[model samples]
Target: MSTNFCETATRVLDIEAKAITGLKTYINQDFNDACQLFFNTRGRVIVSGMGKSGHIGNKIAATLASTGTPAFFVHPGEASHGDLGMITQSDVVLALSNSGETEEILKLLPVLKRLGIAIIAMTGNPDSTLAKLADIHLCARVEQEACPLGLAPTASTTAALALGDAIAVALLEARGFSADDFALSHPGGSLGRRLLLRISDVMHDGSQIPLVDEQATISAALLEISRKGLGMTGVLNAQGQLAGIFTDGDLRRILDQRIDIHQTLIVSVMTRNCVTIRAEMLAAEALKIMEQKKINALMVVNAEKVPVGALNMHDLLRAGVL
Candidate 1:
């Protein structure tokens, strides 16, 4: 028999998309109650399930943990042997069972209840035992499966996953979870670099900073710029405070002026009131200044306006803030 692959794929997508949309109707008072339970829980959220529901539960637990609610996944089958010790009286259990009658999850229900641990059940059958036993029953009911055989846990799992995300976001909002808090949890990511990396962390300080005396010649300034390799040098006053900055752009502007680099002092041609950044500011903020002012580098100064550090686009690029 001939089969249309694209048509079947399209039908599957349509079914799954509808399954996600169908979850909106299930966002009732039960959803709010579940969020309240998670928000108030001093201990972690323990997500337990069997089979494909187990995989979905694992992801749900991770989402909750990352978004501000503390959670982790535990296999219900394992809970019976010794894993039940992991669930404490302070924790809450989010059990996943599509039929609301998984033997493995149901087996742990008694222990969970005995410990006075709250059970939030996500199931397709509200009349099922798991649902009846739960303290909060979240209806993740789906109209049908995307599988043509109508036996697999396709649409049902999709609906449940969406509901889990909704619960996570609701709790995140309730806790006033901010982007900086998320970046802290996810420090290895690009967002973490952009948010957590400060100018002091990435800027070159001490002898690495290119500096020249205000009375120094252009040739001396160029030597400092090339030696430090930051494409610029801060012109410092006799008090060792920043006076102005000389960049490669200034070098180009003076090229045709017939002024001798050996004779012309740096202070004569340096850009006054040059853009600067503080060491405590975010590296991302430094990038914004560079982009807006159309410059490649910044001299990090202190409250005394002394140049303590130097950074360029290359520094930001290396720090993964660009």
Candidate 2:
């Protein structure tokens, strides 16, 4: 590592930290009005800027869209060519510029005004022309740039990014958004599978469920376990209700006692008060319960206490719920 590398890294950290801390002064009525404008807008939020500000605007637009607000990015350079048509009077535009004077963005202001679209300006200078002309102004001023040359966008851009996140989270809370709603927007990811996957979708049903009558011998239960390949079997009484469950652990206990597998009835030796879950429950919830109870297997029962399905640790593992 070079000596200058460590000093540059420290300067970057100090400047960014100060920028975030300085945001407290800017988080006032103007910020609230920006959120309100986005909340009430009938059309999508069209974010635009130039250079580094444009990059920040793109990220802000993405965060808003994923967090329940409808928004997308538009390049200011493109807006002059033909993309300005994308903005409508019903929509709200959020424009970013650290100097409040990016030429490319200034070129579109007259057209935006002509369309009667509301504009929110995010800039460091409140007195600049862009801020004066906007419906709302969000201050993203940083005390200094992190670059030793003090010319790069480093600290100011970081402040803008954090402000964008703050706005998204505030809207999310105001709308009472939940994890399931978030998963819906991110359906292609693992989070969606964890939140939406159900026990019935992962549990073994029908012939895969090991079952035996109360009168069945331990030898018969063992055969059912082997045939079903679940390392366990549900013991049912004459009424067809679940009586107990006999698992591989029980087999070990019986073997130590020298119980005759041929003569012992499963009902007499099977485990009572077994843990179970319903087929309709979330697979993630079942995983939590299994961990809390220190057990690896569970029976799926219906309202009638009839064994409808079964699952073990391996099932959850294969389902990616582990």
Off by over 4 Å in 1: 1-11, 176-197, 213-220, 235-246, 249-275, 281-295, 316-322
Give the top-scoring candidate (lDDT): 1
Q: Model-by-model lDDT, in order?
A: 0.93, 0.90
lDDT of 1: 0.93
Candidate 2 lDDT tens digits, 1-322: 5478787788789889999999989999999989988898899999998999999999999999988999999999988999988888899999999999998988888998998999999998899989999989999998898877889899999999998899999999988888778878877756777888889999999989999999999999999999998889998988888888999988988888988899989989999988889999888888988899877788899998999999988898888766
Write the residue-wise lDDT of candidate 1 on 1-322 in tens digits: 9999999999999999999998888888998888899999989999999999999999999999999999999998888999999989999899999999999999988788888999999999999999999999999888999987899999999998998999999899999998778877888878889989999999999899999899999999999998999999999999988999999999999999999999989999999998899999889999999999999999999999999899999999998997
Which candidate should be chosen as best, given TM-score against the real structure? 2
State TM-scores per candidate: 0.79, 0.82
Count of backbone clashes, every candidate in sequence: 0, 0
